[model samples]
Target chain A: MTTRRTRLSPEERRTQLLDLGAHLFATRSVEEISIDVLAEEAGVSRGLLYHYFGNKSDFREAVIRHAVEDLVAQTAPPAEGEPVERLLASLGVYVDYVLANLTLYRSLVRAAAGGTDEVLALYEEGRAALTDRIFREDAQGEILVDTPRTRLVVRGWSAMTEEMVLSWAEDPAGMTREELLGVLALSLPALVELTP
Target chain B: MTTRRTRLSPEERRTQLLDLGAHLFATRSVEEISIDVLAEEAGVSRGLLYHYFGNKSDFREAVIRHAVEDLVAQTAPPAEGEPVERLLASLGVYVDYVLANLTLYRSLVRAAAGGTDEVLALYEEGRAALTDRIFREDAQGEILVDTPRTRLVVRGWSAMTEEMVLSWAEDPAGMTREELLGVLALSLPALVELTP
Candidate 1:
């Protein structure tokens, strides 16, 4: 296997390792990818791999964390846009990202289902960030009360969006992309209104 | 270990095994409960356990199937309530079931996250049944177009309810059960209205 032979800072090296891990995870099952293979692929010593990740599971978590961060970054609204425009832009980006990275997305789903605490935390963090972004963008500088009920409603909407996107991903022919986005947008006002 | 010594019909014995499995699963991780121990506890041979469930994963799937069926049976609205009353009643039963069976509920969630096809299928089946019940009860014999968009909305609502209920189970003090039911009820009309 070809290996990178470049001197780099710790941060750069960590990013390199995470990128390699994410690439491997996208194509192979977590159980199928071994640390030795990862090290070989990255041209790093096994000790260096462990130095950064501690273990295979930790390495896998880092990869998932990276993917989640990537998703949030990709889907977050632009710095300046109308509330409706930003919402549509975010949703469109989300659908596009999931479609482009279906395999990696499935791996994340599988990891979450496995109920590993670290993985679940990462998934939740990503979910919370996305939800916050949606709310923040929709607020558009308006002072809306952020009560517990409102929090739950946003979370509920986020969960629903995830389920809808996942289902749509699995069966794209079932509904047009525009229809999915339209349905999600249409439901939000009522969902928000229900928040007590 | 205390083992039962009663002779049971095949169906009865299957129920017994499932009950024991559920009991074990409630307190132990799926990996912790082995076939040998389960057979020992159930007063059956290992081969007999295999005869009933091809393997440990299969046995776990069976337990999940049983739980899903139980949830469906417990939460399906009665045949004689008004539409709104039946919807609220079904939601109440669903919340009660999740709250009462938190461990089994967590196991089901974990299994779904784990990306096991059988477990996911069982979850989807349960979700679909619950969503269909909600729609059917809400329709009150009125014929509605069951298009893909409508199906997506119901599924989205079901997913939201699940996330809300799961969150509520984790921290009941965050939202009262009544409030949870109320928020869910209020959202349905808008969701259904958008279901073209």
Candidate 2:
């Protein structure tokens, strides 16, 4: 039997490839996902895969960038709620995303730890976006001076929250999800207040 | 030319090898340091190197373990000061050690991020020792409950302090050492109080 090929626009084809790649990466490590296998799995030619992403490293970076973008979009706070309520809502969304995509999240953490420059850049972009969102919400009506010190505190608190979520993911019985969110939310104002 | 070999106790010889390994690691990446070169540089035979450490990975792990132990010992709090003063003094010593061993510290961070299990074990040992010291000091007079939540807060605070020092090491001018220490010190009590 002959296989019928479906024609698609370039943008649609790229998105398809990215989706397939992300699916594969979510379960297996980047090192284990070969380009040939990805191409075969996507029903595309190896040359087309390279044409879309240049190389395996580039492809992995693109996948990670897409994931980070998704995280930022998914965790963005609603504009109508009180600052504290919005903060909790945002963190709740963040935790849900992490729990839903734990394998992807673990890969992202591993990449941030020792991945390439492109991966690190994408990680920093995601972190900066999150920090900016928190800062905007956390400082809504407070008479706080915005300085490097304040930014440092915000960044530190962000890192702390990430660590807490990561540890919780490793041991779900460590604390209730609500308790984790509560601890993180309370620490934000305390961190801001303690910043010199 | 015949080289003279000095007779020493097993413990003395182990210390000698560890020192030489640490010295070499201080300037070069772990991948670049090989057993042959280490043996040649240390005036020991390759067989003896293997005798002491089963293999290159074992040798590297031993070196890292030695460094962590040194850090724990060097940063141990004095017995005669107030709890706060002792905490500050310990942190100061820890910071000074990192500053003095910046390359080693970076390697330790990299190892913690993506190195082998042995390296990560060594890193965790060091972190646990430091966290235990802080927890013991911070709990000197308080009747706080010892829960997973409290442990999570202490661990999170430890990570924040590390990130602060790593960032400061990258750019010393970003904040005064005193300010960095102050931010970390102040956040400890706040984190403890905020812990649920």
Candidate 3:
């Protein structure tokens, strides 16, 4: 038993724990989940679990951090294409990421709703990055205004993306990905290169 | 006690209960709130509370519905105006509505995040309404988009509105009503007609 447990590397073990924790947190509330259950289910000893994560909140944070990192990595801006094509590629990345991580994504939202400052901060940071990206891309053209206008456009785009992801996650069959992306592509001029 | 109670009609009493309930749910998890506390705080007997709202779930739904209705009512669309101007005016209505119903709005989000199918359905319905409104006023020739393109713009604009509202609800200071609306007005051309 000990040898079987040790077979996996520490990083591998941590990844396993995060996967298990994300599932539990998504299925059950944070207040309802405990360390004992997590350890038992993951086939690791309680001490080992604690050693890896100090407590439930720590575990929750770790899981969230991992999920956010994965999401950021997946949604990284696309390169070497038309600016709008790159934008659409990023949206595609987001759609896939959200679909794969629906449970964890929803839990992140739950965490935000519950006033988890760390989660809220991470969400803000992600949004700020997206906001900054839009300004950077639209900087040269007179189409883009000051930082404040960029912020609003970013805000609108962010809201629209989340709403779409949530819906698509819930009902994948109802809306085809192609249909959705086509609409988004056509709408680009309105959202991106708005004439003054 | 009877005289005091009689002064406030049944509708008034129900509204009072909802207001108190919204406050409790917003600050804490939905599971944490108790009907007893809600009844006492609302200055009504537990029996009377039950009479109006049969159980915890029912009461929770009632509170959410009440909040949704108030939000919708506060932002009634303008009677007549130019399409883009009308859209912006309606957006202003939404921002004002969110500001006025801040607490209840937060509570609605919390209750919606409960992961219950009923709550999820309510959230979807509300979201769809917002989408419908955006799509409805999407200027055809003015924006110059085919069906596919129109859909994307609609989704993008809708998404932005939701994001701004959520952020403003969480922290009004980060972005003010004027700042948000102004930025939105600038970005409006991206999805609407720039010229009057």
Give the DockQ-based CAPRI class for model 3: acceptable
Ranking by TM-score: 2, 1, 3
lDDT (tens digit, per residue) of candidate 2 on A1-196: 7698989999998888887887776677655565687877767799989999998888878877778888999998888877777888889999998888888887777667766667778999999988777667656445234567677776677778887788888885468899888878878777777665
Report clash pairs, candidate 1.
A113-B113, A113-B114, A114-B114
> What tens-digit string does per-residue lDDT give for candidate 1 at B1-196?
7598878899998887887877776677655666777877767788988999998888877877877887899887878866666778888998998878787787777777685677778887888887776656656433234666667766777889888888877865367888889888767667767654
> Each candidate's fnat, in order?
0.69, 0.52, 0.43
Candidate 3 global CA lDDT score: 0.65
Model 2 earns a TM-score of 0.87
The predicted structure with the larger TM-score, 1 or 2, is 2
- Model 2 global lDDT (CA atoms, 0 to 1): 0.78
Q: Residue pairs in steric clash, candidate 2?
A: none
Give every collision pair in model 3. A156-B160, A159-B159, A160-B159, A183-B152, A190-B190
Pitting candidate 1 against candidate 3, the one with the higher lDDT is: 1
Candidate 2, residue A65: lDDT: 78
- What local lDDT does model 2 show for residue B186? 75
Q: Please list the Cα RMSD from the true structure of every candidate, rounded to 1 decimal place.
A: 4.8, 4.0, 5.9
- How good is the docking of model 2, by CAPRI class? medium
Question: Model 3 segments beyond 4 Å from truth?
Answer: A1-42, A78-82, A125-146, A169-179, A182-189, A192-196, B1-42, B45-47, B81-85, B114-117, B129-156, B166-196
Worst 10 residues of 3 chain A by lDDT: A187-196
- Cα deviation at B63, candidate 1, in Å, is 2.6
Is 1 or 3 the stronger prediction by TM-score? 1
Docking class of 1: medium
